[model samples]
Structures are given as structure tokens and as C-alpha cells.
Target: MVLDSLGKSLRGVLQKIARGSTVDEALLAEVVRDIQRALLQADVNVQLSLDLTKRVRTRATTEKPPAGASLRDFLIRIIYEEIRGILGKERPFDLKPKRILLAGLFGQGKTTTAGKLARYFQKKGVRVGLVAADVHRPAAVDQLEQLALKVGCEFYSNRAERRAEVIVQEALAHFPAHLAVIVDTAGRSGIDPDLIAELKRVRAVLQPDETLLVLDAAMGQTAGRSAQAFHEAVGLTGVILTKMDGSAKGGGALSAVSASGAPILFLGTGEHIDEFERFEPTRFVSRLLGMGDIQTLLERFDELSDKESAEKAAQNLMSGRFTLRDMRSQLASLGEMGPMSKLMSLFPGIGAAKVDQKTLDATQQRLRRFRSIMDSMTGEELDNPHVIKADRVHRIARGSGQKPQEVRGLLKHYESTKKAAHGLVSNRRLRRQLEKQFGNAEAPAD
Candidate 1:
């Protein structure tokens, strides 16, 4: 949901186009104007925004729609291409075991990114190690060590050594074989002379496979200048934009960095280490245009729940045997996928529907509360909710620190869900459709 305001504006433009009786020059002009306004308000460079909209206009007017495509589809395709162009090509990271050096300005999340990057590769089945070479910051080494422990990665550091180069050499010497070493370098408030000198020293010794510059998404237009400075200093292989989930200036930072010639390799979506993801320009633009990102969604689901578990859950629901325990597991899986608003944004038409943020937030809160209530329930209560009478409801509410009405509401939801699930389980036509969709044998009717 980064650059949410801009997404809303772009969605509005598309809606207006879809509603138009005809596609004409005037309509194209209005669409272009709306796009320009949205990009500008998102803090995009004026020239970049103008150039993008101009290209969109030319293509929409001159090029004919594909044989089977409508004018609206063609116009939408043009806009998608233009936006993708500004975002630049996707630079995929090689998860192979290799040394990576992280560089950035102070408070740009370089230390945290080092941890996240390690976790990303670890999840990909790579043996990763963290080397803390940030000797200047008092807590840098400790923070990296804590993160390494939290992610279950090897940690290497030296509190006694004042020289970063010496510390890095020692850490590398002690680094475990077959594990990828991620070296964390010191950063300053700005690109100061001392910081540059120290980074150069570390780079010379480490000779890392990838030198990644971490940039803050909220830096806006200044991101380009910062990127250029780091590129000139250490010859960056790629950039990682951090704090993307909460930044309104994410679009500007992304465009500016892409324009500077260093492709964005990953986006730090949230504070959690698992929130990191490799940047994909095409899929990203699709999601921004209100088209679903099925690839990413499937990847997230795969990460949260294995194939066997998913199949088991589906079978249980289809058999009308779902319990409070099953519902809690499902909720946990969804929570791992990140915010509901973000997940919904990946659904086609949902983004354009302009769902209120408050509503999404409330739904997420309610689901969490329901999980909490379930946690307080006894095994027998989870197995058979019908056994819970008025007295049980009061006890459960007190145990969960929730109102009695809230407890009743959860039971109501469970009943409704159970009824719908039974209906689906019994419908022959629906079972056939599901079988076709999943390419699996149909289960016997419950």
C-alpha cells in the first residue's frame, strides 16, 4: 500500500476511462492530465512525470488496439508500460552463497536490511552469516548480533578492534565455510569524508560479490543524489529501498533511484524481517493498476503454509469438519501474509473499489481478537463450540479480556461459516468446478 494516495488517484483515472462512452483525443488528454497530477502529487520529478504522460498519450492515440483487445485495455496497457519504464527493470538477487556488503547513510536501515537480507537467503535454503563491521555506531554491532540470533544465522564481530578493516578481516577468517557472509559497513549522517574512507577500506578487503546501497523510501527526489554518491564511492551493484510500507514518497524514491541507473533489487515492506521481498517491476505495476498479483500471492501462501498443509486444510473445510483450531491456524496463515489491506490490493477490482483503510484495519483487528478469544478457550470448547452455554461464554470473555457480546459474535461467525462450508461441500456442481480448477480428483460428498 505504499504511495496509497497515488494508487487511489490512478485507479480513479482508470475508472473514469472505463465509464467513458468512447475513447477519443479529449478522453486521452484528460487521462494524461490526471496521471500527471497524480505522479506530481506523489513527489515524482516534474520532467519525469511529464515525459511519462506524454509517452502514454502518444501511444494511446497512434497505436491501434490488438485484434481482440478493446481500446480501454490497450490504453491501460500503455499506462502500465509507461509506469513500468519509470520503475525500471527488475534486478533479481542471486541467493547463492557469496559475500555481500551493505552500505548506506545513517538511519537508512542498513543494519536492519543486512538482517532481512540474511533471512531472505536463509529462507531460500542458503547458509548465511552476519559480519558486523560498523565500528562507529555504539549499538550497530550489538543490534546485528541480536538480529543474527533472532534469525538463527551465524554472527561475527569484534568489540575490541577499532579499525573496521581489521574487524572485517578477523570476522572473515572466523566465518564458517559454505555460508554466505554479509558485511555491515558504517554509515554517517551524510556522505562524509571519513565515512567514504572507511567504506573504501572495507570494500578493498572484503571484495564482496554484491555491494548494495540501502536507501530510505521517504527520501523522495533526494534518493537519486544519494544513490549517485554511493555508486560513485563504492560502485554499487543494486539498491534496497527500506521503509516502503509506510512511506508516501515511495514512488518518487523508486523512480529516482531507477533513473540513476542502479536497479532496485528488493523492497523492505515492513519492520519484520520476513517483510523483505525481491522487487518485480511488472508485477508491481500490475498490483498498482488494480490488477491482481497472483504470482506474489501464491509465493506468500507457499511461504506461510506448505502444499500438504494447504491440501489438508482444504479437505477439512470441504468435509465440513472445521473447528476453532482450524480457524485459528487459517488466521495465523493470513497474518503471515502481511496486512489484509495489502493482500486485498493484490485482488483484481478490489483496489479500484477503493476499500476504506479503516475498514481493512478493523477487519484485521477483529480477526486478531478472534484468535485471542480462541486462545483462551479450552480443548473441549475448540472441539465442540455447541457445548459452550451462557456461563461458558462469560468465563471465556473474562479469560480473553473481551466483552461477552464479542464472544457471542465469534460463535455466530463460526456457525455462518460452517453453514456455507457445508453448502459448498454438498453442491455437486461446485465440487466439479473446484476439481477442474485444482486439477485434482473430487472428494466424496460429505
Candidate 2:
């Protein structure tokens, strides 16, 4: 859902290609123009946008598709490749035992990103230690210390020391056993000599393995200049673009930073510590083009729920044994998946761009209301909805502080879901197929 508007525009352009009778020069030109408009609207660098479309145009016109491929598919591939070219190729971020230093200007979410990085590495099975090297900010040390405690990582700071270099030196010795030590450095309002000198001193003491610039996605064209300046001041190995979920100009920042010769190692999708993600150009463009990133979706599920519980939930739904409790658990899992818009973007042909924001908002609200209503239900009513008579419904409505009609709506939904699940359970062939899939057995033949 990052750059949701741009995704809608791009998907609209692709829809044009799909609906066209034939792929020709005129049609290709129109598609290219639409792409340019979308990029420009998303605040992409003008020259970069032009160059990308040029490449798209050249490839679509000159290149021939393979024998089995359709012209439309080939053209789409060209556009995907060109767009990805501007974003750079994917490279693996090293996760070995090393120290990472975060640097950037003020108000780029550096401290928050430090927490995210700590969570990231901790999840990767690395013993992480957070170093508070930002001595200038009044609460920077406290902030990093709290983040360290929240992330369950070792924390190190010398509050009395004014020089950041000294703190880095002490932290390095304090957490030597930690596989990944993340040093949160100070930032200035703008790139200045004092800031650069301070970074140099910290780097001298830290001698980090990776120096990452915590760039803000809203920086747009200025993101490139900032990255270049930082790289000039102190060599930058990679960049982490923060606030990606909320930035309409995220495309601009991503393209600009990639153009500046710094590989984007990660993305801060949201404010939560777990919302950070590694940046992969192919998967990102795939999702942007409404092709869904199945790999990431699977990873998300794996991270949130174990296989046993997931299989049990799936089996319950398939067997028409779903209860209000099961429904509530499923709803909670859905909420854990982040915003509905971002979650929808993970599905092919159903990206957030295809659905209006108002509709999504309404759906989310309904889900919350349903959950609240269910919370007011007793265990007996939750396990067996048939016992929930009109009187029980009124009681639940009053308990949940919702209207009687809303309680009836939840009941209606439950009945609809129960009916649908029964239909699936009654289908012998489909049930067999599902069992085969879930049991890891050989596929059931037609």
C-alpha cells in the first residue's frame, strides 16, 4: 500500500493494456504517457521517469516475445523491468556478527528505526545489542534504552559522557558477545560540519560493518542530495527509507536513493517495531503492479502463527465447525496482519489500488464492531450460535453498547459464513483436495 495512489494509476494503465484489442505503437505510446504521468504525480525525478519510459518504449517496440508468450504479457514485462531498473536490483543484506551504525538528518525516524533494526536482527536469531551513541539529544539515550528493553536486547550508554565516540567505545566492549550491535547516532537539522565531525568520531570508535542512512521517504527529490551528502561525509553502505507506508512520494525517495548509488537495505513500513521489511526490487515492483508477493505473505503468516494453529484454523473452517471463538481468533489474526490496505496489496488482482479507501475503511470498522459484539457473548453462545435467541441478542447488544440491529448484523454474518463453510465441507472433491494439501499427501486426482 506504499504509494497507494501511484499503484492505482499504474494498475489503471495496465488495465488499459489488457482491454486493448491489439498492442501497437499508438497504444504503447499511450501506455508510456500514462506511466509518465503516474510517475510524475508520485513525485519521481523527472529525468529518471523519462529515462525509464524511454527504456520501456524501446523494449516494447524492438524486442520480440518468446514463441509462447503474448504480446500484452511481453509489453507488461518490459514495463516491469524498466520500473525495476530505476529502483535497482535486489541484494542480500549481510546478517552476520557485526556492528551497524545509523546516520541521517533530524526527524527521519532514526531512533525508531534503531528499534526496528533491533527487532529485525533479533528475529533473525542474532543476539542484538543497542548502543545509544546520540549524546546531543536530551532523551535520545533514554529512548534507545527503552527500545532496547522493549526489543529484549542488551543496552549500553554513557549518559554523563558528552562525546558520542566515548559511548561507542564503551558499548563495543560491553556487548562483545552480541552478534549484531546497532549504534543509534545523533542527527542534525541539516547536514553540517559539526554533525559530520561527530559521525567521523563515532565511526572511528565503532568501526561498524555497515553504515546505513535512515532516509525519510517523504524527502522526494531531496532524498538523493541528502544521501549523496551523507555518503560523501561518511561512506554509506546502504540506506533505510522510513515512513514508507504514509508517504505518497515514497516512489521518489526510493528511486532517488537508488540513483544515488546506495542500495536500500530495508523499508520502515509503519511505526511499529515489527513493520520493518527488507527491500527487494522484484518483489516490490511485483506488488506495485498488483501481482502480489506470495513469498512475503507466506513469511508474514509464518512469523505470526505457527503451522499447527494455522492448520487447525483452516481445518475448522473447511469442516464447517467454525465457532464465534474461532471467528474472533481469525479476526484478531487479520488485525495482526497490519492495515487492511497493505494486507490486500499482498494478493494478486486484489491490490489496495483496486479497492476504494472508503470501502476498506468501512470493512475494517465492521470487523471491529463484529469483534466487539462477539466479546459480549457468553461461552455457550459463542460455541453454539443457535442458542442466541432474540432475548440473548438484546442482552449482548446492551452489553457491547451497540444497537440491536448491529447485533443482528453480526448474527447474519455468522449465518452467512456458516452456510458458506457448510457448502465447502459438503463438496467431496474440494474437501478431499483440501485434506490432501493440508496433510502434505499426494494431490487428489480428478
lDDT of 2 by residue, 1-446 (tens): 67799988887787778667899999999999999999999999899899889988987877787544568756766676677678865667877778899999888999999999989888888889888888888698888888898999888988898988898888778776756888998989999999999998888888888999998898887898999999988999999999999888998998989988988989999988898988987667767876444346556765655645555665788877877777777778888789988888665335534668899999999998998899999999989988999999899999999999999999888778767765544443442332333222122222
Off by over 4 Å in 1: 293-446
Model 2 lDDT-worst window of ten: 437-446
lDDT by residue (1-446, candidate 1, tens digit) is: 76688988887788777667788889999999999999998889999999999899888877886444468756866786678779876666778999898999899999999999999888899989899999888699989999999899999988889899898888788877888999998888899889888988988888889989999999988999899888987798999999998788888899999999998999999998888888877667766766444345445655655745555655677887777767767777777777787887655445456679899889988998898899999999988888999999999999999999999999999888777775544443442332332222122211
Model 2 steric clash pairs: none
lDDT (CA) per prediction = 0.81, 0.82
TM-score of each: 0.66, 0.66
Could you tell me how far off, in angstroms, the CA of residue 309 lies in candidate 1 after the best superposition? Answer: 33
Poorest stretch of ten by lDDT in candidate 1 = 437-446
